[model samples]
Target: MTKDIEQRLKNKDINPTAMRLLVLDFLMQQNAAISLTDLEKGMGPSDRITLYRTLKTFEEKGLVHHIDDGTGTTKYALCMEECDADHHHDLHVHFYCQQCKETFCLPNTQIPEITLPKKFRSEEMNLVIKGVCDQCNPD
Candidate 1:
């Protein structure tokens, strides 16, 4: 697993330092978007400043993308294989569980293509549906 993480870091032109490897490994293992608070707690005895920097670097390199689901806090998840340092193609629907307060990426359900009005420019788009998650709603 460590070797795989190292190779992935190299592929992104990022140095696989101890901290970077740890952060990347954690992100790779998660199925939902995680906030810094959660990451810090999950990563015990880690340097907060270094961890923040590592996450920032990953975001810049497109290894991960931030999800601003109107929570006033940003969550991050591993980007899809289609993403790169220059381009991010991880524009899928995000689900925020109101009960658990967790964020999930619904990659199978894509965002509908839209043609905007003339002179109206759009840069980035994020659609997050808020509700109880499957785990929270045991029906």
Candidate 2:
């Protein structure tokens, strides 16, 4: 499992240090995006600064993408295989479950292209749908 995680980091051009491997392993086990605080809590006894740096490196390498679901806290999740340091093909809709307060990446739901004004340039795009998720929906 550790070897697999190391290979994934290397694929993204990220150095697979001990801490990086540990961080990536933890991220892989998560079913939903997680905030820095949540990651720190889950890592138990880990240095907050080190964890934050690891996450930042992953983001820069396109190994992960951070989501701003309007919850005032940034959450992170793994990026698709097509993502790289130069470009991130993560223009997919994110879902925020109100009941569980968890954010998930709906990778299959691609965001439609929008025509902007001639002088307008788009750098990044994010769309978050807030509602009850399948797990939280009683019906």
lDDT of each: 0.90, 0.95
Q: Where does candidate 1 have its weakest 10-residue lDDT segment?
A: 79-88
Please give the lDDT score at residue 128 for candidate 2.
98
Question: Judged by lDDT against the true structure, how good is candidate 2?
Answer: 0.95
Structural similarity to truth (TM-score) of each candidate = 0.94, 0.98
Candidate 1 global CA lDDT score = 0.90
* Per-residue alpha-carbon lDDT of candidate 2 for residues 1-139, written as tens digits (9 for 90 to 100): 8889999998988889998998899999999999999999999999999999999999999999999999999999999999999899989999999999999999999999999999999999999999999999999
The positional error of residue 24 in candidate 1, measured at the CA in angstroms, is: 0.8
Any residue pairs clashing in model 1, and if so which? none
- Model 2 ranges with Cα > 4 A deviation: none
Model 1 misplaced stretches (Cα beyond 4 Å): none
Among these predictions, the greatest TM-score belongs to 2
lDDT tens string, model 1, 66-88? 99988999999998876888988
